[model samples]
Target: MDVGLLFDLRNPAQWHRPWADHYARTLELCEEADQRGAGGLWFTEHHLFEDGYLPQPLTFAAAVAARTRRARIGTSVVLPALHNPVDLAEQAALVDLVSGGRLELGLGAGYRLPEYQLFGADFQRRFAGTERNIREILRLWEEKAVTPLPIQDPPPVWGGFYGPRGARIAGRLGIGLLHISHAMFGHYREGLAEGGHDPRSARVSDLLPIILAEDPEAAWHRVAPHLAHQVNSYRQGSVEGTGRSTPLLTAEDLRDPNAQDTRGLLDILTPEDAAVRIRELTKDLPVRHLIFWASIAGMPDDLVTENIRLVTEKLPPLLR
Candidate 1:
């Protein structure tokens, strides 16, 4: 149960701050998370969103690296089809250097149609393209002529997938899996085994949204609107594989906290509630990292700070 804070850096219109202010506050949160003993700080990537969802995660990651000393910095999943793999490799290497080798790379075949259209990339071929990109990036890293190599021997590689093919590709490449649902754990590990890798050695990290308050209901109320914005925006963008929106969540559900099934997608909990959930989730899976969204769509800075404080004070010991 290595715990971390996930930064999306969204600036929603309803509660928009100036772009500069938003970025400054985001940096503040990262420094705070690092100082408070967070194990890692993960970032999400999106492009051309009304909310200004983070488009250049690695760039921001570099800034975060410069500001924080302890926590590992990573992209939850950087889209490979959007950029030339060779260039991405160089950018990633620089960030790793800036972070003192504390970078974890999670590459994925993205699922948004508009993004693909804007980049003139074939949506249908993104998975194959992503695989090729990963191989090319690694190959570049190994070439003797490549200069300013990453500080880590090679920062650990992770693959983001919504299905088995992605899992198989990652396993075959000896990369870790970034899975969102418990249902995919077995498929991921099995893929690793099939790829001639030991399942026990393959890392699996789950990403989710989290909010904390002593009164769970109160927390839900405070977080609902922002959470809805987070989910609905992604829903509109449309996920590439297996569909983007959670089948269990509807537009109405996003607006009504009670209507959403908080179990799988959202982790709005009290410390006691998180203890139970973490225990159940880790009981059977090799869940190494539990990364969550801390600063999100218009979530008040005070509330975000309080959630970080509460989780830091209470959650880690239970995992031990």
Candidate 2:
């Protein structure tokens, strides 16, 4: 399995620190991770979130490309429904050129209603729009000629799918597939079968919340608030056609707040509990690439580095 790191660029606490410091630390992490043999560094895109979520992932990717020589740079997802397809294609092509063809584009139909409203896009037809945009982007990158042409062949494309229809579309288009953490092994396998393709032939990846720490209590204390943020955001509301939005996960929502829970779960795991959860999650799944979204609300930079070190050092041995 190819191990990758995912950054959401969230500014959880209004900690009194220079923005440049954060960016510098992130670059430090990227360089260190590359030296440690990480396969890639993935970024996320979000708009109008006061939480310091990145609004321009391509720009960030360009910066990353300039700083790091070996690690692949990618967006965990760019919301296709919110972008003009041609412009996005041009930007993506430019980033690919800048990175010497090391670009993995992850496209999504979008899910947050507020984001759609902010973009003035109709939430109902987002999937259709996303599909159309993907087709247009492919054409623009592969067929259409531009003023400054791309340096290499078109960048590899990965379509993020939450349901069967999107998966089928990806299969038809011969694009890579990105599955979520929940029950995606079964869904991805079934989708490949339905598309009349061997599961082994499909290029697939998955993203999940992961942390590796020696002390369970310390890790949970650092990560729980951020976890709560994600769960709350999804539960507040979810767009239709987005598969299985997170249920309400407030502190009150926990049946046993003190209990360390892992029953009936597929991908999520506590750091000290289930070391083999990663293997189990990917066992029957056709995931050659695995990206871990690695941040908890108030996790310190040192702890984050340690978490990355543990995954990079410990997980690869297990896989071998």
- Judge candidate 2 at residue 46 and give its lDDT: 76
Which numbered prediction scores highest in TM-score against the true structure? 1
Model 2: residue 207 alpha-carbon error in angstroms: 0.8
In model 2, the runs with Cα more than 4 Å from the true position are 14-16, 147-152, 180-200, 237-275
lDDT of 1 by residue, 150-248 (tens): 988778888999797888788777788887456676677777787788887777886755666677677676677777787777766775343445453
lDDT of each: 0.80, 0.70
Q: In angstroms, give how far residue 166 of model 2 lies from its true place.
A: 2.1
